[model samples]
Target: MSFSSILGYFLGGYFALVISLFMLSSVVPVAGFAARTLSAYISIVICATYGVLASIFLRIVGREQIAQWTTARAFKYVMAITIGITFEVDDPKRHLDTVRPAVFIGNHQSELDVLMLGCIFPKYCSVTAKKALKYVPFLGWFMALSGTIFIDRKNSKDARQAMAGAAKEIQTRKQSVYIFPEGTRSYAKDPGLLPFKKGAFHLAVQAGVPIVPVVAANYSHVLYIKDYIFRSGKIPVKVLDPIPTTGLKPEDVDELTRSTRELMLKEIVALTQKVQNRPIAIPATSGDGVVHASGADATLS
Candidate 1:
């Protein structure tokens, strides 16, 4: 790693620890849920500020390396230090080396999903997120700098145009796009997924790229509001084999979406069961190297 990259990693962890301690001390007089909430927000703000600064610095010195340092390295360090968030990524060697661009669809559980995905996603990948996130201070500023595609969901016409532009970028630049097909976070008490929106599937078909499904183990057990103030644990992420969209038409979107959802849902259920210490069937591998469940354990930082 370069000197700047090393400095970024150190600063990320330092900022996280400093902010966490300050918040804990400041909230000592306060009690209960309010204190925990305040601490969480404080940690978020500090980490976000660090991210924005790193993004700006990288953009100035090496524009192409911003996401590599900020998201893949620095942000991973911050999350590990602040929230005890770690990842076990699946075997990415086969998929990450593909020449063709792909659409990465993942389950959305909380805002933290973005951080986790950023750490594991392949290089040259950009994110598709709600347009409103553009207003979220430092984080939003960094996202805009990173060329993230933002969709205005309130306006169908605008959203379609944005999606089309994203698809064009994927094809022309051979860059992958990561999107949350769920459109919003799931707040349910149990392990479940929301019905996916069709935009990501549509994009894959339009771009004639594969759809890579990413499943993040349910984090409700760690950060659910009703249960605990704030807990720390591992977040296992599984990246499944890519489903090709070759020779596929727009009409096939529903089937594609359904099949992909089923694949991800099964994985999520199995992951949840494993976490809860319940008996669950291990995923089997197919002849094509696509397994129902397959991945190697990896810690982000």
Candidate 2:
């Protein structure tokens, strides 16, 4: 069958499933959570599937560097419609465009964090992921194919090597990398932060690049897995000003990470006071088609 035919079938099947769950949710409230969760996960599968193909096509064409960017652009719309959430990016300073060869760090929440990535992911960027994720089906396949930097958290030597590779990418290729310094998902109901891992800071300082913090308001109000509370809502995200690491040393990594986390915590607390169902404010994108302030700039990268 042709590509359009395949797409039609997929869309039809997905909507049929989502609609069925919505109807069920009206009677059984937990079904709402199920609908949202399934829709989100399935949407991820869709993006992964597309990423796999996009990566293949780009690799064949020798332009695979933008595979994540291509997939991330498609990811925003696909996941947005399925999950029934809107991402409002606030980047008044256009940091998302001008900055390159930087390390982006963000607060890790639940799975919905991917949606945040979709909203603001820019061109020519790759993500850093845990090594384990390289084992998942389509998602992992796409990440590995699309040039994601995977780190083995359990092995310090391996993790350092991964960071070393990332630092080289930043310096040599001028590539930007996104990382979650929280190291794991918070899954918290309130806007707060866990202590940050210093790898991201180390990478930035080592590479002589700036550190950009992407903060998403606490979204547990939209997706709380423990309580099974998943509903359609808007998430507000802010891309703060970049913190320069041009003259930093290894010893500076600790203070840099600490001070950066403090800054992001303040922003998350402020932005987390989001008002749901408010007017949707579309973030401005530059002529390069890069959205300002996407954290995960997200592979939820």
Candidate 3:
């Protein structure tokens, strides 16, 4: 009879459907992929909604810089719980914590990278996105509120201007930024890297910060849109040693980007091989095991 009643019914129905799909994905072998995929989509919507709310509150309180960090943890928690995946980041050197006002680069995968970002993103850091994503409703709103740097990848002029602005932010705010040098998701079924664009490298050089190479093992085998394969498993990520940009000029960005990609490519392939060859858990465990805050790994939250 009332608007609230209708809205309540719709919300109830949507959640009921998501729960049913999750149940089917668990037991129905023939329908697992389809059910899981749909459930994953719903899970993202749920997390994004949570992110929008959380980030908004944080932004209103003038903590907009860590807004993405708040939302990323939600993504890692909600998606890992609902979708059954763990992002295990192995940063032995703890460069992720020590590095500040730096440029971090990682291999790009699919839309599922939210899980990875949640697992590995350090505090006071935000990611760069294509300018197009600045208008995708709730997710876009969350990104914009959380200080995501948007670049128009197709237009060199706009892209450079965005990077220049990013460099300035790094200097003034002492913020760290993440970029995908591949400039796009690989979506490949194996561990590999695409040719890197030099934007991130140039930004690091201009900002006079170190370039930290973070790598996530290829989980295309776990999440293959082409084959509709959505399995619950771990995505291994490692944060490599940061390469300094002191005294580095624009002309040197090319070699820096090239060498960093080569090193990350090697580590990515190695991590993927380890994840692939490892024996599947008997009872199947989901959620990150690599200690987040304490323990030998000491991966920062």
Candidate 4:
């Protein structure tokens, strides 16, 4: 470890401890809605501070060391500790040890999804983020340094080109890429999934890589819905079997997309049921009762 990284770790730990103390103090007198609200604000500031410090440390250490320090060290300790989030990875041996590059698709719940991925994904993985996230201060700077693929989702042509480039990256660099196939967070009251986007499937097929589905259990119970305060709890992430794309053509993308979606939907429903300790019902209609951008018959090509 470099001198800068060691210093960064120490400073990050100190700041996290201070913030955690403050958050704990907020709930000492009375654990009410007001205390939760105050803790939520403190948590946001803590995350921002960590982001800035991590960015500066990355810059000091230079590009070659960013991935190593940020993923393996900084993110794992600082973010997970401050937020009080613990991950329960199902079948880590089978899913996490794959040597070949693959496409990792996960359901999005909140901004925490990014941090969770950073903490748990394989060493050589990068994420596909929206182009606008590039403007988000320290977090944006860190992501750019880490080689995140930013796509302009508003423009179809640009989005397609971005996916093409991402596919090439997977094929040439042999690095796994994380993508939220739902395109956005499913923040609805219900757990119904958003329609799956085809770009990720296209990339997996084009690169002839396996599609690994990951389901992040809902956080509405532990995370305050009104104010976004995160309480200490286990966030279960179930990694499903990898779907192979070998010998698949462009026309097979739709079938591949549909099958993957079904698998994820089933896993998500089962996971949520486990969390709730009962059978959770899935509404027949789509998420938010409206067709998502991908629509009913959207296909990859």
* Top-TM-score structure, candidate number: 3
Candidate 1 lDDT over residue span 209-291, tens digit each: 99988787777766666653445577788888889999998667667877787789789878778776766553442332112
Show the colliding residue pairs in model 4: none
Q: Pull out the clashing pairs in model 1.
A: 90-295
- The per-model lDDT (C-alpha) reads 0.65, 0.75, 0.74, 0.66
Return the number of clashes found in candidate 2.
Answer: 4
Question: Tens digits of per-residue lDDT for model 2 on 1-301?
Answer: 9999998998899778878988999899898998887787777887877888999999889777788888887778997787789789999998887898788888899777777888877676789876788999867887878877665544444223446656776788777888887777989877777766667876787688999899998888788888889988788899999999987876665577667877787777777655443333333222322112213211122
* TM-score per model over all chains: 0.72, 0.81, 0.82, 0.72
Q: Where does model 2 exceed 4 Å of error?
A: 1-17, 130-141, 150-162, 274-301
Q: How would you encode candidate 3's per-residue C-alpha lDDT over 1-301 as one tens digit per residue?
A: 8999998998788668766766776577535676666656777777777777877888899888887777778778887877789898888888877789788888888888867888888888998776778899866887888888665444444224446666777899888998777767879777666666667777788789998888887797789888777888888888988899999986676678667876887788778778787522222112311111211111111
lDDT of 4 at 231: 64
- Model 2: lDDT to the true structure: 0.75
- Candidate 3 wrongly placed segments (more than 4 Å): 1-3, 22-30, 129-141, 150-162, 278-301
Off by over 4 Å in 1: 1-40, 65-69, 92-100, 130-141, 150-162, 279-301
- TM-score of model 2 (CA atoms): 0.81
Worst 10 residues of 4 by lDDT: 288-297
